[model samples]
Target: MIDGVRAILIGDATLTGLVSTKIYPVSAPQKINPPLIVLIRKDADPNKCKTESGGVGRLDEIDFTVLIMSLSYGECETISERIRFLLDGFQGISNSKDLDIEYETEFDSYSEQAKLYVKNATYTAWYKT
Candidate 1:
């Protein structure tokens, strides 16, 4: 599921041009990079509601935190804005699977250790299993 989401983000020309294949699923490497994108699964909850046929459905509420790290806050903000434009309210097929974005939030932060600006974008995605 996370791979599908990553594919969508990586496939976007605008986003790819900025970060290339620097998007990480869980966390970035130990070596670290100045400008990169990180995808973190914050939480997930299963939908208890059954299907119309009285069978279980593959519905889940998955929350993801997408981080855009850059040397400066302005650059981070710019990349984050492009990411938001590409992903906010997106509904489509990724890796031959259907996914829907339910909600999203974007914010800013600082990485004291790395001394980099972090733009955090959180997304709530609904996946139909």
Candidate 2:
């Protein structure tokens, strides 16, 4: 799921124009520059819905978060918007599976320790196994 989401983000021209290939899973390496994206998978569980035969379905829902970090607030916002446009309400086949991604919520803040602006957004994605 993270791989598919990363592909969508890294494959975008507008997003790459802003941050290049600085998308990382979980955490960025130390000494890395700002204007990067971090992807975190919060949880992934089966939908728990019953099929017509009273069997569990093969659908999974993933809770994911994307964090955009930049040295400037405007840059962070630009990157966040680009990502939002790419992933929000996105439905397509990725990694040989049908996937649907939806934006949930977003929050913005400043990290005084890193002196960077941050925008964090949560998303829900459903896919068939």
List the candidate 2 regions with Cα displacement exceeding 4 Å. 48-56
Model 2, position 126: C-alpha lDDT score = 92
Error of 2 at 55 (Å): 8.3
lDDT tens readout by residue for model 2, 1-129: 888899888888888999999999999999998889999999998876677799887789999999999999999888888888999989998766678999999999999999999999999999777
- Candidate 1 least-lDDT 10 residues: 96-105
For model 1 the TM-score comes to 0.88
Candidate 1 has which clashing residue pairs, if any? none
lDDT of each: 0.83, 0.90
Best prediction by lDDT: 2
Candidate 1 lDDT, 1-129, residue by residue in tens: 788888888888887887778998998998876689988888888786588899878778899999889998888887888777777788989998678874477878897988989888889888878
The TM-score of predicted model 2 comes to: 0.90
Q: How far out, in Å, is residue 40 in model 1? A: 0.7
Clashes of each: 0, 0
